[model samples]
Target: MKTKSLLLAALFAALTAIGGFIKIPIPYVPFTLQIAAVYLAGCLLGPKLGMLSQLVYVLVGLAGAPVFAEGGGPSYVLQPTFGYLIGFAAGAYVNGWLMQIFQFRKAATVFLANLSALFAVYLFGCSWLYIAMKWIVEKPLTIGQTLWFGFLLPVPGDLLLCAVCSILVARMLPRIHSVIRKQEVVS
Candidate 1:
């Protein structure tokens, strides 16, 4: 990878970690700006690097950096919310992949890509929450309860953030690409 790409990936990883600390505390899952950061990473960095950034964030948290929402360590994997951390990588990849397919020039396309990526995040997170609650944590929540806590509760805030991110990305992409092009030429 180019030096710029690596730096940007690292920057995003740091942003994600920072985002974990900025959250509105709630019962099961606190709302965080992490999703917004994830969306921006994918929209700006493209699929592979975006995914790499999120992966680095997760790995760093797992290595006990205290970078996660509720602290960090290998033991965090046992936490019900850890699945959302995993989803960050997957969602970034999916977001960038879709943007590549539909092109990121239009607001609608960017919004659509982000919304789809949101689904991926929720799918992984909700599924993991259900599994962790039922078995690992031995909480044994019903499906309805799991869905309510894991999906329904947090989604409205996420959706609003997604809309804002999509607009930001759409507006910024052209300038970002031009800069990248200039950098490549300079190299």
Candidate 2:
């Protein structure tokens, strides 16, 4: 990877951490702008770098940085919300991969890509929530309850954020691509 790409990845990792700090506390999942940052990182950086950015954020948190919505550490894996953190990296990779394949120029395509990415996030997040609650935390919630808490409740806000991100990406992506091209040439 280019130095510029590495720098951008680090920048997005910081942004994701910042997003975790700015959150509205709720029952199980706190609503945060981390998802938006993740999406933007994917849209701007493409697949490998986008995934690298989120992985950096996750690793930093695991290394005992308080960069997560709750606190952070190795033990954070036991938390119900930890799955969502993993989902961030997965979602970014999916979004970046889709964008690369589709060459998302239209707003609709961008929005679709965002939605697909969102699905990946929910898949990991909801699954983790279910497993953590049932086995790790020993709460044993029903699937319906897990879906309600993990998916349904936070999804509306997440959808709105994704929509906004899609619009932003649609407008800004061309410029970002050109800048990246220039960076590659200079490198």
Largest TM-score belongs to which candidate? 1
User: Per-residue lDDT of 1-187 in model 2, one digit per residue for the tens?
Assistant: 7897889999999999999999887779999989998889888788889999999999999999999999999999999999999999999999999999989977778888888878989999999999999999898889999999899999988999999999999999788779879999999
- Candidate 2's C-alpha runs over 4 A off are 180-187
lDDT of 1 by residue, 21-67 (tens): 99988778899989998999888888999999999999999999999
- TM match of model 2 to true structure: 0.95
User: What's the TM-score of every candidate structure?
Assistant: 0.96, 0.95
The lDDT values for all models are 0.90, 0.91
Query: Which 10-residue span in candidate 1 carries the lowest summed lDDT?
Result: 100-109
After superposition, candidate 1 runs with Cα above 4 Å error: 185-187
lDDT of 1 at 45: 84
Error of 2 at 46 (Å): 0.7
